[model samples]
Target: MISKSTIDKVFESARLEEVIGDFVQLKKSGSNFKGLSPFTDERTPSFMVSPVKQIWKDFSSGKGGNVVAFLMEHEHFTYPEAIRYLAKKYNIEIEETEQNEEQKQQANDRESMYLVSDFAQKYFEDILWNSEKGKAIGLSYFKERGFTDDTIRKFGLGYSLDEWEAFTKEALDKGYSLDFLGRTGLSIIKENKQFDRFKGRVMFPIQSMSGRVLGFGGRILVNDKKAAKYLNSPESDIYHKSKVLYGIYHAKQSIAKEDNCYLVEGYTDVIQFHQRGIENVVASSGTALTPEQIRLINRLTKNITVLFDGDAAGLRASLRGIDLILEQGMNVKVCTFPEGEDPDSFAKKNAYEDLVLYLQENAKDFIQFKASLLVEEAQNDPIKKAETIRDIVQSISKIPDRIQREVYVQECSRIMDISEEVLFNTLAQLGKKNVAEANKKFKKERKAFEVVKKEQAVEKIDVQYQLERKIIEILLLYGNRTEEFEDLLLKENEEGELVLEPELHKARVFEKLYLDLQQDEIELSNENFRTVYYGLISKLNEDDSFVIESYINGLDSELSKEVTSILMEEEKYDLSDWEGKDIYVKDKAESVAQLVGETILNLRCFLIDKRVSDLRQRTLEKKDGNNHEILEEIMNYHQLKKLLSTKLNRVL
Candidate 1:
């Protein structure tokens, strides 16, 4: 466990803008930095980082939190892991508190797996460099593949010993648990005997985008016909092959800066491309491309040029991935090497300038690539040609952007000598079929909701939710500021009629909000928001000098996230350039009292409306008799509603 002092130092040292700017391209927007959301595919900037607040908000995805919270969300880090990452980034030494056995065992399972993977990675590298057999065989193989020592170290390439129990014994001697080793697939247990899983293979450490080791991919060096040439770590808690791309940790910055990614087939291809000055490249690592992999690339760039081996089978295999990329709203281009070459060989064979020039000259957009590849197989056969045309249309239909789809459809028409009308008709049929299927699914889902509604009355949650959230936001932002409040009380006048009379009082914002809600017997309907509200109230009552940062750090991650989101929601987009144009806007602090009172009134009005709705339902259901009291109550509620609306400057 990291001591509290170290966590505080990390929080103080790690600047929000500096940390987030590493992953996102941010521009100055008033007092905050704004950028497109890394969590979502967005054209406009909705992600804002506030250095003053030490938090960030992604309006597009509704994720907001502190720097630690961002790492937890973005990198899937546990709290300690996030803290450690920040501590490392800021060059703060971690101070650890001694843990009891129970505390030690309480470590997150996924974090334990990560620790084991990290240890195994370093262990393999040590062996590859220091062990005699590893140096002679594993290191030699990487060299033979033309990987320079610098490239080898850059990629964290390593080697496992040919002896089965070498790594297992070392790990056990280092006080690491066999369970974790087994869980990470570093050590296999057969009949209760442990041995290394990657024995006799050169190792490639697969990393997450943030450069944490998730697992390993090892290649067997010997020329054994029966043995599999390559073996990968099994899917454990940390590694999902469909979601991880080889060399992404090294390639991401280049991919983002260049605004393009070169997709290749294997690890060597990625390495070779990087060696040849094409740093924006990653490999599917010999697996078929998946939608998850495409979405991963889509985060960095919208354009992907898939480099294929010139073999016919390789081209056929890559055809399906183009449509998948289009479906994700990304641009796909195809580049093929000479007939006898693959990316690894071709990259090694050509100089950097020639390779780049060849790619620039030969890269074809998806429609042209698809048509050219299929035309040879469809020659002299009308049926095959018709099928090929439909295939092209199907790929075009997968594109979500209308302009791109239209351009691709036109290209397909021109290249295949087919009429635009026929291709458009085919696309229309496909779209209609998709919509019909969607409608059937919607109806099925609606039936389930109808049954649920019949079982219990469904509240109008949307408006109430918005009003409740508005109140929470008010409290979170300016809850401690003092303000003048008017207290209303009912009094009988000389005319024998009751009227509301006001008296002035001064109170802190938190005090006023608490009393108003208590008088109305109201609680937030959302459980998470309610918990945070109570926590805020407790802090306001207890502390004389309450700091928002301290309060946020004290809460659990989930509640802290909710509080940050509420505080940051209004900063979703950059404010219009009113100041630049010599226009003035009022600061929120100037009208804090009014904002708080209005939010409280809106919440009360929403509750009263729900009460009136319930009363009307009862009046209707009991129409036979004895419903006069309910109707009278409804009339009184309407009068109350009118007064509330009057306070809000609305005519009812």
Candidate 2:
């Protein structure tokens, strides 16, 4: 168990804005920082980080929580794990309880995998740097490509020994699971034979944007003609090649700082670019550009500048990705190196400032770049020329934003020498076709909801019960306080004799519930609802106003999900509409009124009955009271029963 004091210290030290800002690119919007929702794919920014409240609200996900809770939600961290992550992020040393032997042996699975991967990364990196074999092979390979030792270490570059079973044996000896190794695709298993998957290959650690090692990519050094040149870790739960962009871990800060992303084709190109001081570039790692990967970049910046080598095939291949960038609603520009030179070679020849300057000055809109590149092929050929113009218009049509599509369309018309109206009509038809296909796909799914007085009624009833319980809970929590009620009380006369009073203003519903709960034992099952409910109870104990909205808003989503589901979904039991429909509920919404009358009458009858039983038992035992005392007590009990019966009948 984590100590409460430590939890409090961690919470106090962690700043919500500072923590959330690490994952989200927050820009100041009035009092809050509003940015694109990391939880959802969005074009406009809706994730709000409130520095004042020390919380974040992702409007898209409807998730809002304090810093630790955000870590818990976003990173899937357990409560203690989340605290540890925050403590690590803020540089706070952890204080934890000493665990029993069972707990000590039971390390968290995800953390264990993380530790194993991290250890493997360092071990591989060390071999790359220190071993003669690594120096001869991996180090030589990187240095020959212009990567400095610092850059090698920065990326955790490594080499796998040519020995097939070396890594697997080492990990197994250290008590790491072969199952995990197989799961991460670090080792291949076939019919009880296991070997290192990246044998004799240089390593590139594939990382999440937060820099955790999801998996790896490796390149074969030997010129085995039949062997694949490069191999990536198989798609595991942690790694998806299409969605994972190499070097994003290193480049994200720079991407956000520069407000632009430089997209590249290969891992070495990324390493070389960073080695040359282009910190914002990320690699596609040989996969075709995917919207998932592009949107990851778009999280940090809306503008992407794709760098292609000056080779003819490179330029041709670059066009394939441009359409995807536009489809994602990103501003894209294309810049190519001179013939036979790539970003690596060009950067080695020029300084960082010079390269950035070159990019800024030479980068062209996709429309202009495409037209300029294809213009020669279409020159003096009307058939190909018209096709080229339509091609540019079609790319423009892929953009989802109407205004952005319009602007690009106008630009295309000017460059292609086509009339604006004709191109507009063409783009419109293309967009309509795309929309029709997408709508057909969605509608065929047969998932639609209509409000035809249909509801999950049991859920509604559960919610109404919860509200009445809330009132009951409040009354029980505050019952000690003086409360309003129509109760008869007895007053003392001058001679210290009691006089019966007709009415009294005491026993508020809150007070009654509080006292009753004090005399009873109960526990709330749901933890979050329990906390807020208890908080309300304590306040009512102090006779303060119970603030529901503040409590609801402050709760973490798991709880808010329930409470909001309760408050928002509860209807029909309000009773006013039933009355409007001329439907008289026998009890109407009068839980208290019905229970109150019934209970008073039942108690009156039960007491009259109990007195008769008690007198009978005691008189038979010949204890305490004789038949005369029993007669007086019975007569008095009958008189009290008459008053109770009259009051109960009147109320009912």
Candidate 3:
């Protein structure tokens, strides 16, 4: 367990915007920062971070909380793990008690696999540095590849011994589970025998965006014709190759800072670029480009520059994946090295400035690149040229932005020497074909959805629930504020009608709200709101100065989520720039007393209405036709409602 002092120190030192900005590109919006939702696929910014409050809210997904909550939700870090991450990031020292054996054994399966993967990485790194065989083979290979000691260690480059049982035996003897070992594919188990899966290979640890070791990718050193050269950890609960990008853990911040990502095809390509001072680079790890992988980079930036080797054949095949990037509405540019070189070799040969200059000079938009590459093959062949033009138009059609699609179409027209009209016509044809295909697919699922929609009932608005929620919101925002209020008192007018007369009083918002609710014996109908309300009131009663961050951190996860949601619900409107449209928004702070008074009055009125409803129901259910007492009770409730409504400035 982490000590409270250390956790508090971390919370104090850590900035919510800075932490989340590493994962999502945040742009300034008035007093806060706004960005595309990391938790959802969104084109516009809906994720908000309030530095003043030290909390964040994703309006798209309805997930909101402080920094720790964001880490837990985004990275799936355990509470302790999230604290440690923040502690490490902010250079705060952590004082934590070591977990006992039972505690370690009780870890969940996914966490256990992560532990085993982490252990394997450290063990491999130790071998790479200290073991004789590791230094002689794996270290020598990395050194020959022009990787410095710092670069090697930064990427956690390591080696697995050649012997079959070397890793397996060591892992089992160290109290790590063999079940996790086999599950992570670190060790292969068949029937009753087990052996190292990456024997005689160098290790490259694959990490998530949060820098947790998800799995490993090992490259075999010794030449065996029957054996494959590269092996990746099998799909486990913790690691999915298609969703994981190599070097993302290290490159995320740089990608967001630079507003561009350099995508390559292999692990070495990524590492080499990083070594060459190009930090915003990641590799597909030799897998086909996936939508999940694209989204990982999309969260950070909208621009992607794909680096390709000089091989013409490979470049042709790789062009297919660029379409996927366009489909995501990302601005993609392609750069190729000299005829004999790939990104790894090119970066190794050139100085940092030269490499960067080369990329800047050589990078071409996908349309230009595709047209130039395909135009060569279509030379003197009319049919092939026509097909090439259609192909380029199809790629253009994949772009989601209408304006960007038109821009690319014009570029294609210039490059292929065709009129924009012809290209636009082709684009329209392709769009119709795509929609037709999509409709066909949607038709299959439409019947099932219609059935589900028909079975679903309309949701009703709960008045008491809304009023109770308003009370909680007021307490959270202005509970500590002392304001002047107009206390409404019931008085009989000359005509014998009950009238509300105002009396001025001064009190703290929380004190006023609490007394009003207590006097009326009103309890929040919603369980979550009631729990949070009582807890919040208790905290306010204890201290005149309330630190919302500390209070929220002290609550359990569910209540914490509830409080943050309420606090941030109003912030979404702030992002709309409403004031710029000549529509002024009233600051709730200016009328805290009225806000508190109205909420309480509304709650009282709702309760009285609910009581009247119940009394009427009782009268109807009485089979003996004896409802005189119930009718009188209902009339009294109605009189109370009329009085409350008068106070609320509403005609009943």
Pick the lDDT winner.
3
Candidate ordering by lDDT (highest first): 3, 1, 2
Off by over 4 Å in 1: 16-52, 56-64, 349-354, 379-384, 433-458, 462-471, 480-547, 571-590, 600-646, 650-652
C-alpha displacement of 121 in model 2, angstroms?
0.6
Q: Estimate each model's TM-score.
A: 0.82, 0.72, 0.97
List runs of model 3 lying over 4 Å from the truth: 98-101, 580-582
Candidate 1 C-alpha lDDT tens digits along 170-258: 99999888889998999998886889999999999999888899999999988989878989999988999998999998998898788
The alpha-carbon lDDT assigned to residue 242 of candidate 1 equals 94
Write model 2 residue lDDT over 297-380, tens digit each, in one string: 887889999998888475666697999999888999999889998887888889889988999998999999989888877998
Better by lDDT, candidate 3 or 1: 3
lDDT of 3 by residue, 1-652 (tens): 7888999999889999999988999988878899889988878789999988888999989999999999999998888889999999999998977888898677788888888999999999999999999999999999999999999999999999999899899999999989999999999999989999999999999999989999999999878899888999999999999899999999999999889999998899999999999999999999889988999999999999999888746677788899999998899999988898999999999999999899999999999999988989899899999999998998999899999999999999899999999889889999899999999999999999899999999999988888888888888888899899888888889999777889999998889988888887877789999998898899999998898888888889999998899888888996787888989988888888878888888878778887888888888899999999999888877887878887678986
Q: Each candidate's lDDT (Cα)?
A: 0.86, 0.74, 0.91
Error of 2 at 433 (Å): 2.1
